[model samples]
Target: MFIKSFRPFAQSLRAPAAIILVATLAGCSTFSGFFGGSAKKPQPAELQPVVALVPARQVWSARIGEVTFPLQGNISGETLVVASNDGTVAALDTRTGRDRWRTSIGAPIAAGVGSDGKVAAVVTRANEVVALDNGREIWRQKLAAQAFTSPFVAGGRVFVLAADRSVNAFDGQTGKKLWAQQRPSEPLVLRQGGVMLAVGDTLVVGLAGRLTGLNPLNGSIRWEAPIASPRGVNDVERLVDLVGHVGRNGNTVCARAFQANIGCVDAQRGALLWTKPANAAQGVDSDERYVFGAEADGRVLALRRADGEPVWSTDLLRYRSLTSPLVVGRSIAIGDSAGLIHLLSREDGSPLNRLTTDGTSIAASPLLAGSTLIAVTRAGGVYGFAPE
Candidate 1:
């Protein structure tokens, strides 16, 4: 379900004829399989053993609303901010999962619900950035083009990636344009989950399976490292894009590219630490010792964060498209297309627990709040679970 979201973005660009045909093939469910596409609706794994590595229970579950377009929920300090495509944004308490505030801005939200404790912002489908101050609309500014990624809020500035392959920065307080930076883009790009992470004073952006560190103050390129380069002759075989979440632990940042590889880099010096030939549909997450990722074939892998060596892997849920892994307590939690959340032991990758939410595939990755795990499904079901 998540991989299918990239089709619209590729369609917006003036791609080559071959690339356009492949993108259209990706959109058609029947034709996708002949091209070796893994985006099909796969059957979930049979009932597996629950090891009880950590006792957990669902704290609360609620039907927030419908999200016509896929968008990930954001985790603030004590609030969980989520938005629907129809422009309904809500802030929920982390512990109790109670609604703090929610309001409709009367516009179709295309980009985000990005917040920095005080202010929250979202991009409308009409190419406008809307800022909200404590649930009240503050200001709206027009953008150069439509944005599919989330608004990145940091250091009194809001950063977004437009459909034209440009990054625009605006003042968080007043919606004034700060600086805009453009990069050489492919004819096709992923429409969703292209993230920008703020590391100290620098900004790390994932563009076309390459990592570039930009000076947020002036939008200048500091360093570049390629996660995967264009290789195949046709554009479809060469469609390596940085997808899913980009995570950081201490000074190292890690990201995953579709049909490419997963790699970690030093956020300070932009040094490539390690790159592994892993074809994963989603990104990777880590604790202190190990990094965890979910593959398109329903295999979960664990690698040493220090050296990027394989630690363990499990294929207990093969063929079920899984969400990115989220580590909570001693278990690695991942949601599947069947709406089941599987918790595995962090030590040996053993099945710990399983959860279900609304019987719909989870579009957004799970968010960790304190010790609890908050996940939202495609059907707009929000669930909060914690150790018992």
Candidate 2:
């Protein structure tokens, strides 16, 4: 027997009986009765011995409140900005891990930590977008719907992609609305973070399974490239939201459609390069040569950047919930649910070294700043590592 669990977007809203029934049937599957009673989850693959090929050591550590939502660590120059679910947000020096600034939003945050050095932005659970400057609250404006994706702050403006499939931009200094672009609503949306970033003068975002580019000056569509089209007979199977932490080399951007496909796009031309079947829910990272991501079963894979072809795949971490991969130097770093950071060779998927954090799930994808590698745990443990 097999059982699959699907997380709802918002837990506060209660659906009627009919809607609940339909959602349950669409989101989950079980064959317990057909078997005997229940089925056990597959055991995680045994970890290989670490060889310490990469000489890295934890340099500094810090903390905030425990992170409960999708948190994207924003990097600007030498500073890395992070936020916790309890409304605590802080800026730290990537070199020394010393606090540059620390402040709270005065309300619980749902998603955030987008910064462009001068301005920091976060979306609160109260449906408000909050902007901060040097640890002080500058302005906040109410949003129309919930946003699970971190706000993208750039070009003196803040852009938000909401769960309702709407994109809005606001003045970073005044909280005044600039423009809003709404898309056709879907029956179901993922609770996870979606892709939103800036490439040159274009604003690239993920709406459903399509990578969309818009003019940042005003809410106007520039191009829409499909990574995957919604298929299947039910809403859950048709849910194809693009996840975050995309791979970009110049104008070429690659992303993962939730459990559907992995593909790259030429953002400047608004053209898709290629897409290949990939059953993964996490996003991908890239170097100049390869795109890297972890499958739902915890297999780490690297595909060619020019064309979507598998270069290497490793199942040593299978069944262990893994975060998106981060390409650091010649190695790839990934955090697991057991709070361990695994480093593998970029040439081949071989174990290089392993590091540990407070025994909890990695709250977000690992980030790199200058020469330091940052990983945050669900228990609010922030660790900075550097080459020894």
Candidate 3:
């Protein structure tokens, strides 16, 4: 199921509850690589990631039923919630990879993600928020515009941002719009205690560049600061993905300037705390102490937590791609363009081990739950590794 995205995610996606199961392993050749001679070429990465491969590695592999869509993962109860490009929500027994149930709701299949104990997704054609509970639709609320930004489940309220620049807060149980805010620019991201979006009237929250701090309630201006926009060029025209993240650093709501840099702002006052040159076109990830992502030349740099300063840097890829490092315990688990997951020692960027997966990465993120390290390939393979 991996040559390319089964469906296109453009503008406001309308899902239709589609389901597709890919049994294609022809591309598995890419992993085995007849692409080049196995002379043990040391075309090194800044750090080499190591994984302990015992029979323990292959915990289990399940051929889940027809699942079409950019994949999203979540852990609920003992079930793992996965949404498919095909408009269906499914629940799988996390331990044994057994099917719990499958519920099909007519909606544009979305890469919608899961939050809390629930999965936030939108129906294909209806453009409504549908809350799913173990393969059952708890509630569905129709919206004025198409919904994007996979339903964000925070503070027990299912917060969803629409492509039309509206923040709709719904009753987590029964997809009802409890509060709605409209702003100018699209509300592309969500943070725990930070601003809501980039531009808009009633909800144009978020302070980047020089402004800082925002009120999540009304999208009001709170404070300001002098933040230097990351020094770089925007190659993707006006294509900016405002995927904001909450740094484990408490009240800091961190955002990235696509193809530019990273901005850490005061989540409370909209005050620009700091801006560090990142040049990541897609997005970034951090653990309060350091932020890691590609710089101008596809070199992954780790910057300090307090002030944005370089601590370590390494080669990530040739042209530049999107998988960000999933910082686990003492190792940095990063995915490459070739469906290879690497682990690096955090102290000094040293390669540890590598693991192979089914497809390449387009939207792969490091998954950290308890001691399990999870990596999801874009074509839809979830890998669980022990963070040695």
TM-score of model 3 (CA atoms): 0.70
TM-score of candidate 1 versus the correct structure, residues matched by position? 0.88
Q: Is candidate 2 or candidate 3 better by TM-score?
A: 2
Leading candidate by lDDT: 2
Q: Estimate each model's TM-score.
A: 0.88, 0.90, 0.70
State the lDDT of candidate 2 residue by residue for 196-308, as single tens digits: 88777788889989999998878799999999999999766677788887888888998999888999999889999999999877888888999999998899999999999
**Candidate structures ordered by TM-score, highest first:** 2, 1, 3
List runs of model 1 lying over 4 Å from the truth: 1-42
Model 1 residue 339 distance off true place after TM-score fit, in angstroms = 1.5
Query: In candidate 1, what are the lDDT values of residues 1-388, reduced to their tens digit?
Result: 3112111110000000011111211232211222455667667668766766677789987666666454767776788888887788889998988988998989988777677767788999888999888899888899866677777777777888775568888888888898999876555555555657777667777777778888887799999888788888865566666665765777687777776788888878989888888876677777788888877677888988887799999889777777777777788788877888888888978898888788887767777888878888767888998888
User: On residues 1-388, what C-alpha lDDT tens digit does candidate 3 reach at each position?
Assistant: 2112111111111111111111112221111211256666444345334445321253544443333443345554566565555565666665555567766776555446545555545444456677776566788777776543456554445666654455677767766567765554422221111124322112223333333333334334456554343233431232333433223355554555544457776544455677776554334456757866554345666777677878987664533343556666766666665667666666555556666666555244555555665555556565665533
Angstrom error of the Cα, residue 347, model 3: value is 2.5
